[model samples]
Target: MIQVKQLTKRFGQTVAVKNVSFSVEKGQILGFLGPNGAGKTTTMRILTCYIPADEGSASIAGLDVFENSLEVREKIGYLPENAPLYPDMGVIDYLNFIAEMREITGLERKKRLREMIDICGLEKALSKQIGQLSKGYRQRVGLAQTLIHHPDVLILDEPTTGLDPNQIMEIRQLIKEVGKEKTVILCSHILPEVEVTCQRVIIINEGEIVASGTPEELTNKALGGQTIFIKIKGPKGEIDSKLNNLPGLVSFRKSSEEGHNFYRYEIKGDGHREHCEDLFRMAVDNNWILSELRMEGASLEDVFRQLTAKEK
Candidate 1:
């Protein structure tokens, strides 16, 4: 339950976010995506009350962020881009400190400490000092600190950054599991990770809101049409010419991979999945041997690039 309306943040003359607006529904994982210097972290900071916006308003669970920051803090768990961690504090000790800061009761302090230890997989590192742990374990320690209070919303800025591939996968799985119960806004530069973790996405660029929707919706709208791929065991030059001359076809890409011909034809066929026959007929007319064919929807990456570039 998070809402940001016309949210604008600026550092003097340099604007970090401009007229950015979006909403996150309860128990939903929203992927906040952008390239570097795209203001993703700045937006997250505004939502978490780490910084104030130049204009507009933001709310968490209906509590106004600017006016009721304390209450909002009580309801959110923020893991910043680079979480501040004491190098010498023991893992459990750091969590204990955060628990006290969150004003957890004596019983909750103990109970939540146990849960954080288990949920974040910090037991083995509990007695170890934070600086001595590996990057992955340190990340888990950061997660433990954030979850110490059992907040309702999680604002994670690149939760898997800097971790090895295995560690990144582990943390991604953990985020998905957490999202099943808590509203999550996952901000990351890794596209595949976001696609796997969030069903909805918001793309921002140049301090403005570029696109927002489900992955499928974004792909469909960005393509502004439809796409299909076809493969034929034929003379490459002839196949290329046939596709290039085809009408209603937006574009075509021909390739030969591992001795097999491949072609991706962009078209505005209006949901007519029967175009495979058209490609087949063209192949027959050219006396090209038929090998394999497939039709695919536009990809999320393609949509993201299209929308962001268009806005630029």
Candidate 2:
């Protein structure tokens, strides 16, 4: 429901986004990730029509964002990092004002207001001024206003910022429910949140997209191998020699030394073979007691750091 083609933007001599292109299908939630000064917000601003791109085009639900700015606005709901709110307005009044601005009136307006209040859990705060609400409630109010018009697409920038763990989970679940029927582009610094909530992820760096894939795909792509952790009770010197000689093992290091001659080791393999069976046989031949063995892949955070970190 959203599309961009080689979108580029500049501020003076600095290029904020360059040749960036991607799409979000209906009912899909996309995680847009990047480090600070990486042009993530700039691209979001262009997509939401807050700013124009210097090159290329963006469209929402088949309408050009630049040519049909008004219609495009009608099709997408944007909740910026700092929600645009009037601190003095009560929650109900604020939502009503936004509904009116969206041209929703009469019976439709009432229905939408009720829906937003219910969906955003804003009933208790309806009578309170926005400034009086807690940070979590303020975010809820921001969400209520954003969804007051029931737009087809949702663009959220740091929606969970400043929220406590409980509040963050609440908003995360809410976004998942909304993504059941709406296209969503979520921008968050929280890697775990994005890993669990988004269907796909796009990582941008230095004004360009460096990676795009499912979490599993990106993790595997980044590591190009499997990480194995094992604990064994044996002579440390013999274990090290055997590990070094294991075929297809990329590298191995002693992670820790447990009491009673047990040691923990981390091993890396070339992703082409399994080492557990070989290690088990070797341990049996040498009468070494094995305690722990497990393999893990790289995490989203690992992939993000490798792709976006400066100095190559």
Candidate 3:
């Protein structure tokens, strides 16, 4: 449970975040996206109370982030892009220190420590000094410290950085599981990970929110029309004629011509099944060999680009 209203922040002459407002419901995993210098981290820092906003207000779990900064920190597990860690401390010792700092003690502290080790896959590196660990291990340690307190909210920025593919998937699944009971704000440059891990998305650009919605909703909205690719073996003139007359076919263009009368075409239409069905039936009726018929839809990456790309 979080809410922000007209939040604004500035550094020197540049505004890092401008009149931005959004909310995340309890148990919801939100993907916070943006290109470099687009204010994603700025927003998260404000929400986490790491810095004060120049204007506007924000609250988490019903407590004002500014007024109750300490309490808010207690309720949130924040893994910043560059994790603050002590390289001299062993993984287990550093985690213990964090547990104590979080006020967890005795049996509960031990329980949390073991849970973090297992959940973060730090069992092998328990005795290793943090500096001796690889970057991936260091990331795991950062995640462990963040979750050691079982906070109600998680603000993770690039939580999977330096992790191998297997480690990435493991962390991804762990985030999904944690989101079932905690509010999560995942900020990352990896679009596919966000597409699958986040239930909703908010894209910020030039310090303002450019788009916000479910992944599918954003993609569908970005798509002005359906794109279909088809390859057919037939007389080029006859095929073009039939395609032109097909109902709901917004437009078609021959992309290339292969040998033996086969041609590839790019079709744009309203994208209803009827249009595709009509094309299939047309090919069958004309006895034209339909070698390929596939549809392409806008992806999260496409939507991100469409919304955030700058003009020269």
Worst 10-residue lDDT window, candidate 2: 216-225
Q: What value of lDDT does candidate 3 attain over all alpha carbons? A: 0.91
- The TM-score obtained by model 1 is 0.82
Model 2 stretches astray by more than 4 angstroms: 233-248, 254-263, 270-288
The total number of steric clashes, by the backbone 3 Å criterion, in model 1 comes to 0
What are the per-residue Cα lDDT tens digits for candidate 1 across 1-312? Answer: 888999998898999999998988877999998877788889988898889898999999999899999999999999987887998998878888888788887886899989988888877887789999999998898888877777899999888888999999888888888888899999887877887789799999888878888876776666645666665676667767777777656666554354655443334443334667788888788777766666676677887777666443
Ranking by TM-score: 3, 2, 1
In model 1, the clashing pairs are none
Q: For each candidate in the order shown, give its overall lDDT on alpha carbons.
A: 0.81, 0.91, 0.91
Better of 1 and 3 by TM-score: 3
lDDT of 1 at 69: 96
Candidate 2, 137-180: lDDT as tens digits: 99988888778888899999999999999999999999999999
Q: Point out the higher-scoring one by lDDT: 1 or 2.
A: 2
Q: Using Cα atoms with residue i matched to residue i, what is each candidate's TM-score against the true structure?
A: 0.82, 0.88, 0.89
Which stretches of candidate 1 lie above 4 Å from their native place?
223-227, 232-290, 295-299, 307-312
Cα deviation in Å at residue 154, candidate 3? 0.5
